[model samples]
Target: MRKTAHRMVWDIFLVNMIIITGMPGAGKDEFVKVAKSMGFLDVHMGNTVKKYAYENNIKIDDTNIGKFASDERKKYGMDIWAKRTSKYILDEDITIVDGLRNYEELEYFKNNYDDIIVIAIFANEEQRFERIIKRNREDDIKSYNEMKSRDDRELTWGIGKVISLADYMIVNNKSLEEYKSDVKSLLKTIIDSRPKIREKLGL
Candidate 1:
């Protein structure tokens, strides 16, 4: 079937999406913030999981939420989170998806979207732990042991494989200002290099 005029226009203008995958506290949130400032909409997979748990009356703790996500993956396949989160994605020029934890999820988006780029943010374990402790979100790991356990759970879900397969990798081990600068510059380059986006932005 031929495409509608609106569909053709969307295809012409939108740059599609960027997938952000990183371990907990690897600055995925910061990356989203920068992307948002650059006019990209975002859908966070973790928030999707948490919202599902909330509506189901499941206690919103790390363990319960993790188990729910894992069980869903086991039942529906490894891309379950991606399936759920995709509902929240908007038809924007560029959408940044955060909290991608596994290879199947990556493949789900790649198979569905026309243009997708996966970016992995990396920080050494020590740095990640320090940042997690400093940030102290309610669901964050409270100790090194808990962080280790969380890492193991994520690895079991194939996060390491996804990270290894990322199209771009950003090391977020420096000062926040410097890291933000690097992220901004890299995102700008990615956006500017897109032919349609370049024309849209008058570049």
Candidate 2:
């Protein structure tokens, strides 16, 4: 019984978490899709906020959604989004958290999880803008000025700092196939590193 209980504890601690941080339209969704295909459970912070807004009947436009997210941070502290989204994490051995926008959110995961990896995806502004335009999500800004404003807002939330401090970075400025290949390689590296991590933990 003692050995079984100890093994259970080790298994629990062995779970690995990957947090994805990037500017809007920087291929985070694509990364999440790849991570999902690799069997990592996905939790998107922006989707959580949007769900909350929909539940409360808040307008879901770009400005309103941004304000709602900011208000949530102000009301519940800078880690509010992280705290809220964390509830979706289950007993999965690997989980991919997408849409981390601030350093406080990263800090929350660092303080809570023993095995956490931060991956940042980056693209040139022009590339990102073109992707955003092509995606045409209702909440996306329609103009370059609006996109710039959104970038400023996100940067103010410490996204740039989070990206700078990432454990790994994927530059998504190339073709789709190239980006996907890079993501797949990174995922394999992360998955391959897990056994070493478990060994070090005496699991």
Candidate 3:
């Protein structure tokens, strides 16, 4: 189809860039929360998929629709989401992003933004699966296997490469207090390490 060709061509034409990656329910959102509370802004890529799903009346429970939203993104590239989220970055002093799963998406961002940070948050597979089942955003997924399927789909979507190339990693496997503490500590380190963060904000 024409759509598929566009995605392949876009990938070939675009440069690969930095991105933070992890499976669903890995506290990518929570990390964003910590960042925002500490003066950083937050944006989520999944909002793009969710918005497309909503406009088309694609029930969150529709696995096929989720597949379509993801597939359609391959051609135009996830920068579609990055472009939207970029608007928020301009409105803030510091920013953090949630829901990255492909290198092309990351590249689109790094090429446009300066001093971008790619932080990956991860937990054990079992924990992430349990978290997804409980989230139950889609009634279609009610078992361990169903959650596994979602994760596998993301992996196939190029999530692994993003994770492997991350500049930093956070493993979420402890109490919320501990995780929050780690976030603060890690963020401070990243801030100190990246001059772009301070330079852009005039800090």
Superposed on all Cα atoms, the candidates' RMSDs to the truth, in angstroms, are: 3.4, 4.8, 7.0
lDDT of 2 by residue, 51-153 (tens): 9999999988899999999998988899999978866766435678898888899888777665789999999889999999999987898889999999999
lDDT by residue (tens digit), candidate 3, 68-184:
657677767655666655444442245567777778778867766544667788899787876776666653466777777877787877888889888889999998789999988
Off by over 4 Å in 3: 1-19, 62-65, 84-88, 138-140, 195-203
Q: Which regions of candidate 1 are displaced past 4 Å?
A: 1-15, 199-203
| TM-score per candidate, chains pooled | 0.89, 0.88, 0.79
How many clashes show up per model? 0, 0, 2
Q: Tell me the deviation in Å of residue 31 in model 2.
A: 0.7
> lDDT of each model, Cα atoms only?
0.83, 0.83, 0.67
* Candidate 3 minimal-lDDT segment of 10 residues: 9-18
**Candidate 1 on 97-172: residue-level lDDT in tens?**
9999988888878876667999999999999999999988767788999999999999999999999999899999
Positional deviation of residue 30's Cα in model 1 after best superposition, in angstroms: 0.7
* TM-score of model 3 vs. true structure: 0.79
- Model 2: lDDT equals 0.83
Off by over 4 Å in 2: 1-14, 196-203
